[model samples]
Target: MKVPETALPDERPNTGARPVDYDAELRLHNRAFRHACAILARERVLDIGCGAGQTTRDAARAASAGSAMGIDTSSSMIARARELAAAEDVRNVRFELGDAQTHSFPPQGFDVAISRFGTMFFADPIAAFRNIRGALADDGRLIMMVWQALEANEWSLAIQGDRPQSSAAFSLADPSLAKKILDAAGFADATFQDVHEPVYYGDSVEAALAWIGQFQATREALRSLDAAAVERERTRLREAVAQHHRDDGVWFDSRAWIISARCR
Candidate 1:
């Protein structure tokens, strides 16, 4: 399936979306989700925006009786994911490069469709959701997780100090907007729930800063700033995260929406 080009312009920064090394954090999120929701063991599943294919591979392993496929727009991510799957010797999982926002799926193909921190950048939320719904079988389910809001997510808020607030335009951060878009997309039984999770950066704060600095959007914002300015922003982020530090380590007070619905 091909992703429509229409929904990308709004979210695409001057530099395209880049590959991120969130391997550990992603695994953690996956584990937490498994705890919260019933695993689709033995159920055919499609993972949209499946970066690195960890979740897809995990699903295939955990649900050995089922088949799993992962799709993403980034070739680098897809390639890396394939390598990871091969290394892990996961035979039932496969990765492909595709646009999830507009990809066409076979009728009654997937029992479950899921995404993690994906779908947040969709330029057209309604259209994106509508296309996703087409991938599922009758009464199939959709499960996705996205940032709740800038204010509630200390990690995003810490990183985005003066960046323009998205309150004006359509944003996935707002749970209300999520419900609205899902409803408009013809899905039923929409629900949103809060999830608090820890994103361990490193042994120290500096390591965490270095890792997060690779974000394309965040880097673009720092492009115009002088070294002093960039450091100032880093200091602010450090202090913000420090508030959440404990004996275990520093953890950002992150928030996400666990949105679910079923196709009619």
Candidate 2:
């Protein structure tokens, strides 16, 4: 299925024709986040922590008369994002490697800023957002998707069974705290919409296993186990993932928030 440039929250799944190598889990959230963005022509966009430029490219496509720039801390991810943009001939987008919290973005340069599960890792969210706010035009919008909480996401639980859930990914789980942070950072009217969707792992059990194994939590857990214990753990993980398998793919329920706010 060719993913639409924009979609409503209630739209049907559009991943049936996605490339096999695409990030399946992210594809689920992509639809909702892109829909919320609603990029417009001639509007400059900035994408924070844009992993591999998926969101940035989407924004660029929609903002055909404008331009989009993506920033991330990972050099490799930035490089890959550039490569993909070039390969796809998306000329209106660019990627940079930098930390959002301190990066000196052009003042009031962007009409919109966006993220996809990417705003949860700031060492200091208030400062980060303040900087972002400075980069936005007056009344500019911020649209982002963030995981609700570890307990609310089945994919994390299934993959890292029983492990103490501690990650930057869930930093913005509390709606009240998120609102407070945004308000303090010069944003107004922070609102959140609940998003419940099943994250796709892969088309088969083995494929899903390979993808899950690449997670830092899973790899760390396996490294701490002895060879025999590791094998047992792998077996356990396989069984857990298999439980969610369907004729089309492996999936797990997840909950997230699509938070939208405006620059004060």
Candidate 3:
């Protein structure tokens, strides 16, 4: 769930994958949120990089008595999120478009902060986390999921194909470095757990290609090549997906870090 080095709106291709790939996203990221929500009786929650507000809406349901706010840098995403919430008649949720890195979130405004496939793109992660930390109450909880190394994640490796790795997406892939960044950002009690999940690329090979081909990085990589070369690479991608195809869909082996920390 990483994006090319671009604005937040263009961060992801609107392949309608988020809703369809619920299993992948949940196994890799939301499992922690669900587990935490089950044990803790929370009142307020904040969801960052809350792509379509699904996670935000879920958290709002958990904090039914309180409220949940979803923030992202993409206005269109926020709009669609708002529409979804409205359609569901969910009143406890709200979505805003703003960069978490510099956004002045209300201080001590939330008891829990969550990010799924977000936070990796922050230009200055320490500053971003510090800002997020400030938005939490004392002893507040921070929960998020980050991708693992390139070698561990076959999904990205398949897409790479001699392409340069995305710096922003993989910036926090290393647990040690992620811990150091959190520590510097005034978060404590860092715990990183290994999570292996199946990421659904598409229902079929053609579907997968259509969705994956829209990735900004993919287009960038292919932009330099001629049609024949692009087709060759596309064929390679199709072949790679074939090996991982399943009865349900095209699933890629994925590895992520489920991180939990308390604001210091």
Candidate 4:
């Protein structure tokens, strides 16, 4: 399905530019993540690295009487998340600017912790997951949606063809590695469910270009090129993106893993 645009107005002063909707590219993934979460009523949820609070707000809406709190390292993102939550009148959710790895969460405070493509960037995965486990109640759930191997995701290949892939985003692509980390972090019975879906880029080629151009990989690649080479790369990228445009939107095939575990 064509995901509706959830881009909110940028309230930041002096920028005079509409903030890029980072969530647009992952709306379909978010739908699947939400479905996999299946948050229960009265379950206090902690959302790690929740950009703009989209998932946190969804959890709050689902939990109804319960509450959701989102934590992120970006101050701007947290501010924007708060604004969106307030604007949407979602009173059961809140956002905080903090890193999950070292943030001191209230002990045994949350019933569940969730992340959407957010857990892979930790400088120390074991320490981060251990910290998260400390915040959960006995047998509290940990659910996350993470990308699979780079070879399995067409979206990454389309955006970054033949480039050396060193991104931390793919750190947990291996189930064995993920399970080991969880095991050391006091989690047990970890399971991974495969999720195949098309990630939406935008409604048109131009829109897709605008969105993809802001990617770190795109910027780094373009920054290393000479003027003519930069233009050539842009042309190539434009063509690659154009190949994915259709009547619905610019879509790319993606594969992810829905990982679920319980605190031991």
Q: Which of the numbered candidates is closest to the native, going by highest lDDT?
A: 4
TM-score of each: 0.83, 0.90, 0.88, 0.91
How well does model 1 score by local distance difference test?
0.70
* Whole-model lDDT, model 2: 0.85
Q: Model 1, which residues run further than 4 Å from truth? A: 1-20, 166-170, 234-247
Cα lDDT for residue 92, candidate 4: 93
For residues 133-240, what per-residue lDDT tens digits would candidate 1 score against the true structure? 887887788888777767876666666777765542226767666778888886888787777776765444444554456656566666767888876766776666
In model 2, where do residues sit more than 4 Å from their true spots? Answer: 1-22
TM-score of 3: 0.88
lDDT of 2 by residue, 149-264 (tens): 89999888887777677667888989999999999999989899899988887787765766666666776776687878877777788799789989988889999999999988
Off by over 4 Å in 3: 1-29, 37-42
Worst ten-residue run, lDDT, model 4? 6-15
Descending-TM-score candidate ranking: 4, 2, 3, 1
TM-score of candidate 2 relative to the true fold:
0.90
* Each model's backbone clash number: 0, 1, 0, 0
Candidates 2 and 3, the one with greater lDDT: 2
